[model samples]
Target: MNGLFDALERAAGPVTFAPGATLLRGFALEDAAALLAAVDAIAAAAPMRHMVTPGGYTMSVATTSCGELGWTSDAQGYRYAACDPDTGLPWPAMPALFDTLARDAAAQAGFPGFQPDACLINRYAPGARLTLHQDRNERDFGAPIVSVSLGLPATFLFGGIKRTDPTLKLRLAHGDVVVWGGPARLRFHGVLPLAHGTHPVTGAYRINLTFRKAR
Candidate 1:
């Protein structure tokens, strides 16, 4: 048992099980205020909305995007596009701080040279939730997914390939960054309904920025 545990620990990838998928605490929050400011700016330009699913159901969480590509879902289906369908305009450009954080986080997780081209920003209010789903919209699964948590905390559900597979619930706090790729690239994941809370920075909301290589 010790040998097996050691082997798993020595695996050539990110593996920090804090009773959940993985937990890397206090990764970096130096520029969190700046990042949130940038988010507010983007939101002002392209307001976040509860996008409709292909099945016509409005999502519980409000979403916006930036970078070269943005993830969108509608009757056409979930996919990455160069512009926001709501407005015939390109999504906001990826902020330099975001790009730097993603690349640095990926490198820390053992996937270096990561250059993400899409960043999906999600805002979750009290009672908002995200259903379990795989992030397969990207053209390449080789690139890792870097998710940054800000404002109110959230419970993240990380599952395996099969939906029925048992999942680990992770408590993600503000300024936490979670990176997954390689064998965990296609893992199913989602967020449970957020509990009521008030954050000084976000004011009763949870903001998540997920960076991906959409091209």
Candidate 2:
């Protein structure tokens, strides 16, 4: 894996990477602290946990949610549920700050009036990675996805509709926000295995907040 990213390009954009995808560099730095605090509170209410895929493998990332619905995966399959399977209660409400940031980020990315009903939080430690996959479980594909990165940096892979299509490996660091939708809604994406590192804000892990309109 040492030379995995050698052929890929690092993203330095506050620019559009695709027709409907925008990478806003440092867009969330201003709200970083507040967001982290909110994340802590949300996690306290509904602790993050590793989920099991239908195939029975445990995901490397720890996850939680704060919204009307939370995505869950298990022996049954992946689906959105109103309550946290671990807690047997509704997930914490999405914070106003999170809602506002999602809205503003979406608007800035040319997808105005975006109101996300779900915010999936993912925590990744060193060596943790997400494989290429599409977010197609949402009830509506008309809504865009807004993702915020915090803590240690990682390479984000954005690919075409098919998993075999060429992918772009973009360096997504603290406070970076990526919004994609429209014709790019079903594009495949994932995160490369995280490198070992420490960040002042997140210690040894990275936190990602992904907002989506699930309903």
Best by TM-score: 2
Candidate 2: tens digits of C-alpha lDDT, residues 147-189: 9999999999999999999987888889999999998899999
Considering only N, C-alpha and C atoms within 3 Å, which residue pairs clash in candidate 2? none
lDDT of 1 by residue, 1-215 (tens): 34534453354444555222344455647878999999998888778999889999999999999999988989889998888888979999999999999899888877899999999999999999999999998888889899999999998888888888877777777888888888888889999999998998899999999999987
Count clashes in each candidate, considering only residues at least 3 apart in sequence or on different chains: 0, 0
RMSD of each: 4.5, 3.0
TM-score, model 2 to reference? 0.94
- Residue runs of model 1 more than 4 Å from their true location after superposition: 1-15, 18-22
Please report how far candidate 1 places residue 188 from its true position, in Å: 0.6
TM-score of each: 0.90, 0.94
Looking at candidate 2, the ten consecutive residues that score lowest on lDDT are 1-10
Tell me the deviation in Å of residue 45 in model 2.
Answer: 0.8
Q: After superposition, how far is residue 176 of candidate 1 from its true place, in Å?
A: 0.4
Q: Local distance difference test, per candidate?
A: 0.85, 0.93
Candidate 2 all-Cα RMSD = 3.0
